[model samples]
Target: MGQSAIGTKMITQIGILVHDIEAVSEAYANFFGVDKPAWNWTDTPDKAQTEFLGEPSQARAKLAFIDMDSLQLELIEPDFHPSTWRNYLEEHGEGPHHIAFVIEGMKEKIAIMESKGMKLQQKGEYTGGRYAYFDSIPQLKVLVELLENDK
Candidate 1:
């Protein structure tokens, strides 16, 4: 399998980390037309499995979503846990946290990326899927999130 075998697609969502959920959610709603009940937010799911730096880990974040036709915008406030959201905020001072790509054959994709020198920084799960943060910042200048979902 060559490099292009991964079959990467368009970004499905843009994830951002903010210091204040309500303030940032309201601002995004006002400026970008994020809709009501955007508060369908939640704490880090209990059943969701996660890992960081090759060790089993628990991570938490306050999450809200804004639908924008084909693309979704995610607002994340790092909860008091071990998460990339927390790391990004502490290291980069808050902004776009990650850009996501919904992928097929996710395990293979991850292996390929790693073979090409990318680092697997974090792993997280939600309702129907799991996701990974690839440390592509050195080359792409931003984190690339790959999601494998049942949707």
Candidate 2:
């Protein structure tokens, strides 16, 4: 097969949205035969940096990242808020939510996805990174998360 419209983004995360991050992360650890994630945190979008479909949104989630050889496995639990995770859970239940890519050329990547007719579903920034989710459900069967992290 040829290349996709989204281009060759280096995937960095396999993201899963669950009802309970701690419970599911532990389950994933056992299933994958690895220890639980060493990196874990919570994100509550600061209103100033968060947008859902270009509008402001109050989204919160608990996140955990398990270190793999090449890529990281990400676990997320939707807090009681308006967010992609909450929507996914309500519509599809807990499961794989999105695949994430960490890229350096953030603007270029976003433009590529936009050129492909993908809509920005969610976007926010954290300490060392910015993340955006694109509406790629029909083609990829899930949303695509673009991550640009300095750390």
Candidate 3:
């Protein structure tokens, strides 16, 4: 396979979209024998500066994280507002959403992916970093997310 456009092969996360975060989280906790993590709402559009399909969006989601041995498992329950998460859940139903990588040089990484035919689906800011999701299903069978956290 060609070199990774994002410049690293390590997967930091596996995001899953679900209809009911609370129930799913509980189930996962029981199965994994781990405490159920609390779910929280993602930042508002004003704080996240979210954009979907190049347009500003008011998208948000309830998110929970479960730390695994190697990578983080993310459970997302997106609100009605338009976003990659919402769209995927609406069209495909609940399941794997995207695989994520921690990257530097966000702009350059996005350019490379776009050049390789992976169009960006959504982007937004979080507490101490930013993230962008690309439509890479055609090649990888799932979406790819680039997370650039502050050093």
Please name the candidate that would achieve the greatest TM-score relative to the true structure: 3
Candidate 2 residue runs with Cα over 4 Å from true position: 1-9
- Residue-level lDDT of model 2, residues 90-151, one tens digit each, is 99988889998777677788888888877888888887888889989977778999888865
lDDT of 3 by residue, 63-144 (tens): 9999999999999999999999999999999999999999999999989999989999999999999999999999889999
Q: Residue 100 of candidate 1: its Cα lDDT?
A: 89
Candidate 2 lDDT (Cα, whole model)?
0.79
Off by over 4 Å in 3: none
Candidate topping lDDT: 3
Q: List the residue pairs that clash in candidate 2.
A: none
After superposing candidate 1 on the true structure, give the runs of residues whose Cα lies further than 4 Å from its correct spot: 1-5, 40-46
Q: Point out the higher-scoring one by TM-score: 1 or 2.
A: 1
lDDT of 1 by residue, 1-151 (tens): 4444457658889998889888888888889764643554443456666777777666777788888989888888876667677888998887898888888777898898798678999886778888889898888888888989886
- Candidate 2, after superposition: displacement of residue 12 in Å? 1.4
Residue 94 in model 3: lDDT: 99
> Model 3: how far is 7 from its true place, Å?
1.5
Please say which candidate is ahead in TM-score: 2 or 3: 3
Comparing 1 with 3 on lDDT, the higher-scoring candidate is 3
